[model samples]
Target: MTDQKFDIIVYGASSFVGQIMTRYMHEQFADESISWAIAGRSKSKLETLSKDIGLSDIEILVADASDESALKMMCERGKVVISTVGPYALYGDTLVKVCAESGTHYCDLTGEPQWIRKMQDRYESVAQKTGALIVHCCGFDSIPSDLGVHFLQQHALKKFGQTCSQINMRVAKLKGGASGGTIASIINMVKEAAGDAELRRQLKDPYSLCPPDHSFSARQRDVKMAYDEEYDSWIAPFVMAAINTRVVHRSNAMTGNNYGTDFLYEEAMVTGKDGRGKRMARATAWGMNAFMVGLAIPPVRWLLENHILPKPGEGPSEKEQLEGEYDLRFFGKTSAGDKIKCRVTGDRDPGYGSTAKMLAQAAACLAQDVPEGAVGGFWTPASILGDKLIERLREHAGLTFDLE
Candidate 1:
């Protein structure tokens, strides 16, 4: 490869989550050998951010999302590009295309299933051919879920002589607020699927991210609010399961079903262990379900977009972010009936503080630690970064993965 301007270019470094991610990389990689820079649509904002964060020496590149030529140029300059600009369905389409064609690695914090499906269909082959590893949902929405499964299965194989035939991820604890950009993506997803029957179908498919030839033998659960005899707690469907489950399944598909062809997975939040807990779980689940349906309604969506929810470039305060934390528990059952458990926890808020660090470390892992001979294609975190990223998260991102 020709000498590039930097090792990685953070493409949306002026936005809320983007700002956190840039500041994070700046502090963490402060005397490191890695070369990196920040880029965004506003040169002045990028300059101001550089000074505010005390990284004025780092170069800033200006490029609008719609400018394909500029995006392609940006892609060519960085070995990897970290994009935080979202409701990706609106802003990410062209950038992924340019990155795929330019043979540049890309990662984004997108949780929109329909848009991801479209990108996979349109760019998977091109990305594979051009040696670009495009990965998505490398954030709180899925990384903990994806990599938790990965960590569990590895230990399951070692202890049980086989991978898990089924895995369940429980969001045991989480203290964080969602980013406005994340809220926008959810609203856009609801709106897009409401009008497109095919998109709706894909959204509901557990194996939507799997290839056409893929088949499974395990029976997946119909994710919903329910009582769990195992944990003795009331469990509610996780809002992020719709996205994280697909990423986990995609990891299995991309890895040639390394976990197993019949592998099954589920994700949910655990309430408490009594009747009141069950009531609360059902209430929370049904409330979120209704909220999703409401967002699908034009009037409700308009009200939320205009009045209720925070807009893009807005999110929780630094105090709230620093106070955020999450704990996930994974239960795995091997084909032989052997069982194992694992946990993944984060010290920062799940949505902003943790997500920003996870995305940055994911990009850094790809740029520095990917195995030789790994080709580019649409990939999930478990299938691409795996242990290297797990290590990075633990060492630098306030994330820990431990087997129980």
Candidate 2:
């Protein structure tokens, strides 16, 4: 293996979220005795971003996704690579492959389930053999959900002598907007599923992301409105549930079903406290269903994507990010009926600001804290980083993990 020149490399540093992540690293961790660099396909753009973000002297590397040699060379220099580029299925496959083969750790913010499954199928064995920890969904889409479940299970075992057999994740409060990359990823996901039957089948499977022979056959909530009697509130389908639930299940599989062989989990947006809340929940649910249907139609999808959706590299302003916030609560119950509830909350917006910080810390945790002989393979953040990441995020990323 080539000599490691950097502890972490922020690949795709020219992308919107990429710039945020690199800037965060410079601002927060520059003096922490870790070597890092900003890299992407364009040297000039990287240089400009560095100057704009007051990181003018930061090391910069250029490597396009299409160039295997350049990517491999880039992979050789960094012990851990943080990739912010996505619809990762399109541009991230090569970098992940290079990292696995080169024994370099890797992390990304991809919420694409089918693509993640594809990566696991092709590279998990190689990464395990080479000691490369390949972790995905480190950002808002899955981190809070995955890690929240992890934290809850730990507490469950400590308090009840067993892991939770069920977890119900509720979005208690959220105020955030989407970025262009996220919109594009969702659009691409729908388009890809439109033609591929197997992909559609996989997308529908709750066990799609879990390892074989550990599939949990339990009821799950889809995109439909319902009342959550436990919360005494009306609830609507959460958009991120499809991706986040899969990541949580993968964590369970990675941990050898430590959570439980019959674990059941579902996610929803808790609308309100009373009858008014129930009315709003029904409307929200129907609206989401309509939106999904509209996205599937060619004309509606074209108009919405072209006219309303943000284009690539576009995002909210710094002020908006600062004002954004989210709170996710997970309620768990053991087979004996004992219960506990915990929360994961972020100070900044979910899609960009908080995500940038979470991704940066995840990369740092892998680069600096992952113990030797950890047996690298396809992993979720909770499965590999666990409490180490929870601590980093709480200390530096403006996140809180609390029992309620």
Candidate 3:
């Protein structure tokens, strides 16, 4: 491992988020203190990315998502690989396979739970033996939620001597445009669930990403549209809750239920208080339901894909990415009736701008911060990276986790 040529390799470096991340890496590590490179299926695209970013000295590696030999070669050279190429269910399996077999650490921005579960089921054992620390949902989908919960719990223990029995996260504000890759992943998930009853059922479980032997059977709350007394606002389902909650639960399970077996967690978007809030909440719920229903139908899905959604390489412009931001609030309560509140805020777009930095920091953390002999397998960001990642996010990723 010490002989690895680079500390990290940014796989799929030609993708939308990957490009943003590459620029960020150049800005953050221009000193070349941390050895890194950019990689993708297209040598020309990778070269273009390097040129466009004015990163002439950065190395570029070419490897298609499904080309096992090229992927293996790429995996063998880096201690950690950051994958930004996604609809991960379609193009992510081979990279995970190669990384696990070669003992390379990995991180990605995938919010697809089904694909994550499949990877865990198939590669956990191999990664454990080889010491490959594969972590998913390192981006906007779950990092704020997973690490937000983790930050709150640490405070709870310090202040009250007991972890929270339950925690609720509400998105107070979010401003971002979705990328085509994100939409494609959602559509693919719905497409698969439309035909598979088992996958549909699994998607609904908050513990779907947790280990199969875990004893967690808590019936998690599902917010459709409801008035909340805590924040005094109407709340609606969070689009990322399905994957985020599962990742948080997996963190707890992996840490021996450090959050407690009866722990409860849920996430939603706050729609404000009173009449207007209720209307907004109802509208949000309806809109989400309608969107999912449309994606499930072949004709409607095709229409949305071809006409309504951004294409894979398209995303917010530079100004938009710089202007985008999010504010997330977390409320936690212990069994002893002690309560705590905190907020996690990002300085850029949740989906792309902020996510790109988060993913890059996660990969850097895996490569440079994780202690040697750390047990490796499938791990949630908070479960494995924990405080180290939180620090990295605050220091370099434009994310702030603060107690209120």
Candidate 4:
């Protein structure tokens, strides 16, 4: 691995989020500081992205998602590979396989739990043996949630002598627009769940991604719409909670159940404390439910894919991305009745701008911070990257994880 030519490779560099990440990397890292490159199936697209981002000197590696030999060759040359190509169930298998077999560290912006489970089942052993540190959900869907829990729990342990037994993450403010790539992943997940009863069941399980031998059987709570006196707000179901909660649980499990086997976690968006807030909560819940149901139906799904949602490579403009932001509040309680509060905020759009930065920092952390011969297998952002990544995010990714 020391002989690898590049420290990091940005796979799918010409994709929507990929392009954003490339620009970020160009601005953040000096040539002497890190050896990284851009990669995708299209040489022309990669070249254009490099030119557009003013990354004139960055190397470009071309490899299609399905080409095993090319992917293997690409994987073997990079210590860490950051994948922006997603709807991962469809296009991410080969790259992950190659990386796992070649002992390359990997991270991605995928939020697809089912696809993550598939990859874990198929490649976990190989990765473990080869010492490939594969981490997922390095993007908006779960990073803030997962690492927010971690940040709070660490403070809880230090202040109260124990971890939080229950934690609730409330999105107080989230302003962002989704790209076609994000919507496509959601649609593919729904389409899979609609056809597979087992998948639907797994999707509902909060610990679906935990190790098979784990003993977590706690019944997790789901908020449809409710008034919370604690925060003085009306809460609605969070669309990303399904995957985020699972990632958090898996992180707990992977960390030797540091959060306790019976730890409870939930995520929701907070509406204001008023009649209008309650109405908004109900509407948000209803809208989310309707969207999922519509996606399950073939005709409605087609309509959404073809006419409603953004297409691949289409997303919010640079202005919207730069102006967007999120404020996530975490309220935690230890078993001894001690309380802790914290918040995680980002200065850019959650889906594209913030996600791109978070993913880049995660990959860089994997490349530069994680020491060689660390226990390796599938990992969540918080479980593997932990404080190292939190530091990077605060310093360079325009994110704040602070106690309130």
TM-scores, all models, native as reference: 0.97, 0.97, 0.98, 0.98
TM-score of predicted model 2?
A: 0.97
TM-score winner between candidates 2 and 4: 4
Tens digits of per-residue lDDT for model 4, 1-404: 43557989999999889989988998889745778989999999999888887887888889999999999889878999999997898999999999999999999988899999999999999999999999999999789999999999999999999999999999999998876887889999998888799999988888899999988888899989998888999999998898899999999999999999999999999988989998999999999999988998999999999998897789999999999999999999999999999999999999999999999999999989986668879999998889999999999999999999
Worst 10 residues of 4 by lDDT: 1-10
The candidate with the higher TM-score, 2 or 3, is: 3
Candidate with best lDDT: 3
In candidate 1, position 255 carries an lDDT of: 87
Q: How many residue pairs clash in each candidate?
A: 0, 0, 0, 0
Ranking by lDDT: 3, 4, 2, 1
Candidate 1 residue lDDT tens string, 1-404: 33565778999999899999988999888986678989989999999999999995798888999999989778878999999999899999999999999889999999988888899999999999999999999999789999999999888878878899899888899898767888898888887788889888887788888776788656678667888877779899888888999999989988889988878899889999888888989898899988988898899889989998988888879999999999999988888888899999999999899999999999998899989999889989999899899998999999999988
Which residue pairs clash within candidate 4?
Answer: none
Clashing pairs in model 3? none
Q: CA lDDT of each candidate?
A: 0.89, 0.90, 0.92, 0.92
lDDT of 2: 0.90
- Off-target runs (Cα >4 Å) in candidate 1 are 1-3
Error of 1 at 359 (Å): 0.5
Score candidate 4 by TM-score against the native.
Answer: 0.98
Candidate 3 residue-wise lDDT at 88: 97
